[model samples]
Target: MNQDKRQILAQYEKSMTWVESLADVTEEQWRTPIEVGKWSVAEVIGHLIPWDEFVVSKRIPLLFTEDSLPKAPNVQEMNANAANSSRLQSKEETIGKFLNGRHQLIDALHHLTDEQWQHSFHIGESELTLYRYFSGLVEHDWHHFLQIEKVLK
Candidate 1:
């Protein structure tokens, strides 16, 4: 595989492994916010789940078709809802949902042809590639992982 594909696969691995690393977090810690008015550790992982589904169901498929991409999701409301909805879940349930979505996304991505790695699509003001879009999610995963760490601290 090319460098970009290697990087893409690496990110997927990193995202899953990073989450798995947190499997030992106590239930109390899962609900505690890393900072005031920020998402709790569970909420943050809940938020990450939809982005993966979006990539698999919307973003990835858009590349192989002529249809226009859907408008971006409402982040603030989505975040709020995800957190609220997941608040009552057991730690295992929350983590299971996250893992299911992540695996679904990774599976969808694995079927892409080499040419699809370089596939381009427009999002808002920018034209971006499949590789760039997925890489951004990797960064997104790290951003949350860091937040979860700070909460643990």
Candidate 2:
């Protein structure tokens, strides 16, 4: 409801539109590898689900109980982890999971207080506000979305 939350929600809505537009992409296109190298559209969607799930389920709770956020893993390490995840589902399944996870993220963000929106979390040696984290999510989504769009073309 506050400005920060509103901004996050707006960015999320834009992300949702970008992702949903891929619904019309052919199955072969979904399976096509994007410029990110190892990630297909399906795998990209698979990766996104865990991010939202981590924020909504794990990281947020940790913020309330722990003194600091967990050390952020390197991007390559995170990608490797996502690649190894057995839970990565099929194209249709990943799409559905992404949609559900995105909705959950939106709902959680909507309910956070202004104070909570400004709460700080440590990622590696750096401190980040919830707003920065949300902005990071938006940046990540657009980065992957552009890669996917290029591959689809």
Candidate 3:
């Protein structure tokens, strides 16, 4: 409900508007791999799930239960794993899962207090507040959304 959290939620809402508005594309379109080379729409959606899940279900809880940020996996390695994940899913299933995870992220952001938003955590060598993490999520959404749009074209 603070300004930072409000801004993050607004950004997410806007992004979701685009994500949710995408419709009528054939399954072939969704399964078409593009952008990050081997990543299809299904894989992109699959990739986003753990990120949203991490922010909502993992990081937030760690803010209270643990004294520090949880150990993060290597970014390059994780992307490699996503690329290799054979469970690419159907268009409907991928989109539905993304929507569900996105809603959970929004709900989690809505509940954060001002202090929590200001709390600092380190990712690699960079220190970030909760708001920064929210911004990162927004960036992540847009990055993949553009990839999806480009592939559809």
Candidate 4:
């Protein structure tokens, strides 16, 4: 496999492995706040799923088209919406969404040819590669992941 594919697959595998590690967490543990004023583990996973869904259903497909890229969503609004909606959901449901969202995203990108993997999208003043875009997501995953780890420890 090429470098982009390797990185993409590696990131997906890393995320899935982390999910697997959460299989035995208790309900209270899942609901415990990571910090005094911070989100619970479920809430953090809640925040992630919508972006993954957007990438699978919208962003990746848009990247393949000639149309101009859309403006970014309001992150605060998005996070608020996710937290509000996910509060009604069980911890298992939130985790399942995270797993499903990542699976769908990785499966969608796996269909791309090497050329597509190298495809660049110009946004504002910068051009971004598919690799860089998705690698940032891997970092995003780790950002919330550390919260889960720190509090759970």
Candidate 3 vs candidate 4: which has greater lDDT?
A: 4
What tens-digit string does per-residue lDDT give for candidate 3 at 1-153? 678888888988887677666546777776778765577766776677666777776577776544676777666777666544525455666667678888888887777787778778766688788788778778878888887888888
- Candidate 4 residue pairs in backbone clash: none
Candidate 4, residues 1-153, lDDT tens digits: the string is 568888887888788779767767888888787898888777887898888887787687788688877766888999988987667888778878888888888898788778887778876677899888888888888888988999889
Q: Write the per-residue lDDT of candidate 2 for residues 1-153, one digit (tens) a residue.
A: 678888889989888877877779888788777865577777777777777887887676676555666555566777667655513456666677778899998988877788887677677677888888888889988888888877887
Predict model 2's lDDT versus the native.
Answer: 0.76
Highest lDDT against the true fold, candidate:
4
Cα displacement (angstroms), candidate 3, residue 66, comes to 4.9
lDDT scores of the candidates, listed in order: 0.81, 0.76, 0.73, 0.82
Off by over 4 Å in 1: none
Q: lDDT at 5 for candidate 1?
A: 78
- Candidate 2 residue spans exceeding 4 A from truth: 64-66, 71-78, 84-88
Poorest 10 consecutive residues of model 1 by lDDT? 58-67
At residue 36, candidate 3 shows an lDDT of 54
Q: Higher lDDT: candidate 1 or 2?
A: 1
